[model samples]
Target: MPDQAPVRSSALPVSDWQQALDTVLQTPVKARPYSAQIMRQSPTAFLFLIDQSGSMDERTTYRGRVLSKAAAVAQIVNQTLLELALRCQKGDEVRHYYDIALIGYGGLNDEQAVSLWSGAAVGKFFLTPAELAGATLRVDEVTVERNIRGRAVTVTEKRPVWLNAVHNYRTPMKSAICLAESLVGQWLATQQGNDVYPPTVINITDGVATDATADELLACCDRLKALRSMDGNVLLMNIHVSDERGNSILFPARADDLGTDQYARLLYDMSSEMPTPYHADIASLFGLDQRTSYVGMCSNADMDALVKFMNIGTPTQHNHSFTANLSSEP
Candidate 1:
C-alpha cells in the first residue's frame, strides 16, 4: 500500500503533519467563567430557597439567645434583602440592581415549594429593589454592637421583617430546587443577549431532604447550574443550618474539611465554585482563605457565619459616604 497522509485525533483527513498540528492547535480553550456584577442598567436576580421543615423548629443558640432555625432564616432573608436594597439606593429611589425571590419549602398551607410573600406578592416570583422595600410586613428594632475606639458599643437599628418564621411537617427540598431552576430559567431568558449578571440561587436548609432522595436533589442542583445568560450561569449556594452545636464549617476546599458528614459533602459538591474576585472579599469579611478551591457552601453555620455568607453572596463595589450621628468620645 502507498503511504497515507496523517490523520487528526478526530480521524479527519489531513494532508501532512503540519495540518494535523494546526487542527490540534485550533481547538479553542474555554475561558474560566466568573460571576457578573449586579448593576442598574443590567440587573441580576437573587433567589432564596429556604427550608421551613419541622426540624427548623428545633431551637439553637445564636448570639447568646436561643432561636429556631425558622426564625434565623426569616431574619437572615429579611436582613439580606434590606442590605441589597440599601446597596441599590441612590438619592431617594432604589435602583433596580436586583430582582429578588423568597421561596419557602415545607409549608403546611402552601404546596411543596411556593412563594412565601403574602397578599399581592404571593404569585410573584421576582421583585424589584423598590418593590422589595415596600413588601415588608412590619419593621422591628434590634440592638447590635459596633466597635468604637477599640470598645464594643451597643446600637439600635430598625429591622424590616418580610418572611415570618414557619416550621412545617416535611422538607420538600426537591420542589424548592425545581422552583429555583424554573425561576432562574425565566430570569436568564429575559437577559438572553444582554451582558447582565447571572442570577444567584442560595438555598438555606437543615441539610435534610424529606421529599426526595439524594440523587434527585443532586439532579435538581445540576439543572440549576445549567441555566445561564450572556454573562454566566446561575450560581448555586447552600447553607446547612445544623442544630448540632460546635465549630461551623465555612467554604471547605475538600470533603475532608467537612468531616465525615455525607450531607455536607453532597452540598459541597452541588455548590458553585467561588469566583476569583470574590476571594478577597470572602477572606477579608469571613477570614476564609479562598486562594484555594472552596465552593459556595457552609455546613452547620452559626448565626454570625450565616449572616456573613449572605453578605458575601450579594456584594456591591460601590462605596457610600456616611455622616456620624452619634457623639464621639474623643
Candidate 2:
C-alpha cells in the first residue's frame, strides 16, 4: 500500500505579517450604482426571504382573490420563479442568466431561516432557471374573477408550490437576514471581477421580529445589502403584508408617508433606494407620477401591487418582451 504524504501548514512570516495586515486594512471599498445590464456576461442573484409566522394567517385580497398572507406570498414567489424560468428558456434550453434562492423563517421552533424548497431542492443555495423549473413538488389550479376593461372575466391559473403555507410562532427576521448575508457574501466572492449584477433580496413579512430587536434586524439587513459585485451593492426590498383593509401604499420617497408606525419606518430605512429605471417602469405600468427617489419598501400592499413589485425586482433586462407575449398565458 502507498503511504499518503503528511499535510503541511504555513503561516505568514513574522517579518511580513505587519506589512500584510497594513495592506489589508488600508484597502478601500468602492460603491457602484445598480445600472448594470443583466445578461449572460453578468449573471445576477435573486433571493427571497419570507416570514411564515402566525400573522401570515391574516386574510387579504389579491386581484379579487381572497387568501391568507402566507398563501399569497407563496403564490407570488412561485409565479415569479416560473416567469424567470420562462424568460431564460429558448428552444428547450434554459440559460444560466440568474441564480435564485427562496428562504422561509419563523415557522420552525429553532427560529432559524431555512431554504423553502422541498423534495429535491432541500439545502440548495442557488438554482438555475432549469433547476428552478424542475424544483417544485406539485401544482395547484386557482380560479379568480377579474374585471378586464369593462367586462368581468374568469381567470384560471396553474401555480406551483415548493413551500407550503406555514403560520407558527413569532418572526425571526434577523436570522433570515443573516442567512441572506451569508449567501450574498459567497456569491460576491465568486464574482470578484466579472462585472456581475449585485444580488437582490426581496423580503415579505407581516410583523416585527420576535427574537431580535429592530436595530439588530436593520444591522443584519445593512450588512446583507453592503455585499457587492463589480456592478453595484446588493439591493434589499421589503414587502409588508397587512391585514388592514385600508389603502395600500406602494413605493414612497419618505418614511413620513408611513405615519407613526415604527415597524414600517424600520423597514423603510432598511430598504434600498430604487434605481431610476424602477420609477420609469412603474410609471409605464401604472401611469403614476414618478418620484425623485423611491425606497424599495411597501406598507400594506395588496395582491395587484405585490405582483407588480415582484415583476420589478425579478426583471429580465434583455427579455422584457417575453411577458408581453405571454400576458394571457394560464
Candidate 3:
C-alpha cells in the first residue's frame, strides 16, 4: 500500500494547557451553607490568636495544677492541635483536612505578634495535619484522671508540645487581628470554590488591646468577620481568660446577658453570631437548651471554661461522619 499522511488526533494541542485549566476551573461548584461536610477536597482553616501579654503571667489553676495563664493557654492550645491531628489520621496517613495558624501577640518587649509554630513548621503561617504532627518541639508526660468500670484511675501519657508559654509587654490585640485578617484574606483567595467552610478565628486574650480602643477593636473584628465563604462568614470567637475567680459568661444570647460590663459587651459585639448548624453541638457540649443562637465570645473564662469554649469554636467536632468514613477506609 502507498504511504499516506498521518491524521492529526482530535485532542487539543498540548500547548493549550492553559485553556484546559481554565475550563476545569470554571466549572460551577454547588454552593452550600455552614453545614457543609468538611473533607479533604474542601478542608477548613483555624486561626488562633493567642494572648501573651504581661497579664498572662498571673497565676491560675489549669487541669488541677497551678500555673501562669500563659502556661494554661499553651497547654490547651497544644492539646487542641493534637486532637485535630488525631482526627485527620486514617491508618498511618495524616490527611490534610485543615490548615492551622497560631499567632501569639505581646510575647516580646517590642509588642510584636508572630507565628508560634515550632520545630519543622517554625515561621510558617499555615500548617497541614501532617506538618503539625511532625513539628513537635518536645514531648512531656502528662497525668490525667479517668473513670473505668466505676472506678477513677490516674494515668500518664506523652503529650507533644509545639507552643511555649511567653508572657511579656502589653496586648497588641488590634495588630494581631489585622494580621489575621490579611492572612485569612490571602487564604480564602486560594480556595477553589465558595463551598469550603469559612475559616474560624479564636482570640484568646487576658486584657484589652493596648494599641486600639474598644470601638477600634470591634471595627477590626467586624472586618475580619465580613470575610466569608459560601459556607458562612468567618467565625470570630473571643475568649477572655482571667486569673480572678469570677463566674465566666459563655455563649451569651443577648447583650443584656452580658450585664453592665463594658468590656464583656464589647467582646460580645466583636464576636460572630454562633451559626445555626453549631447550635446543636453547643447545646450538647455546654448542656444548654438550644432555643436561640448565642454569641461566640466568652468573658472572665478560667482555664476550665477556656477549654470548653475552645472546643465549641473548633470545627472538628462537627465532622463526626468524616472521621467515621476515614476510619472505615482500608
Q: Candidate 2 at residue 75, lDDT?
A: 79
Q: Pull out the clashing pairs in model 3.
A: none
What TM value does model 2 have? 0.81
* Model 1, span 1-330: residue lDDT tens: 111111112222334433433332243322644434455656878889888888889887666778997887788788778877887677887778778888888755234777766544545668888887566777899888999999999999899887889887788888889878766665554554455566789999885888788888899999888666655567899998876777777887778888887878889878988756566667776787647676899988877788878877775323211101111212
Model 1 stretches astray by more than 4 angstroms: 1-32, 35-37, 109-111, 143-156, 316-330
Compared with the true structure, the alpha-carbon lDDT of candidate 3 equals 0.77
Could you list the CA RMSD of all candidates, in the order they appear?
A: 14.0, 8.3, 11.2
The top-ranked prediction according to TM-score is 3
Tens digit of per-residue lDDT, candidate 3, span 1-330:
111111211133444533443432354433545765567777888999999888899999986789999999999999999988987888889888789988888886435567777676655778898898667778999888899999999999999998889898899999889888867766666674545677899999999899888888888898888876666678899989987867678888999988899899989999999867667766776777786778998899888778878777764554532233222333
Who wins the lDDT comparison? 3
Worst 10 residues of 3 by lDDT: 1-10
Which is the better candidate, 2 or 3, if ranked by TM-score? 3
lDDT of 1: 0.71
Ranking by TM-score: 3, 2, 1
Candidate 2 achieves a global lDDT of 0.72
* Per-candidate total of colliding backbone pairs: 0, 0, 0
Regions of candidate 2 where Cα sits further than 4 Å from its true position: 1-32, 141-158, 316-330
Instruction: State the C-alpha lDDT per candidate.
Output: 0.71, 0.72, 0.77
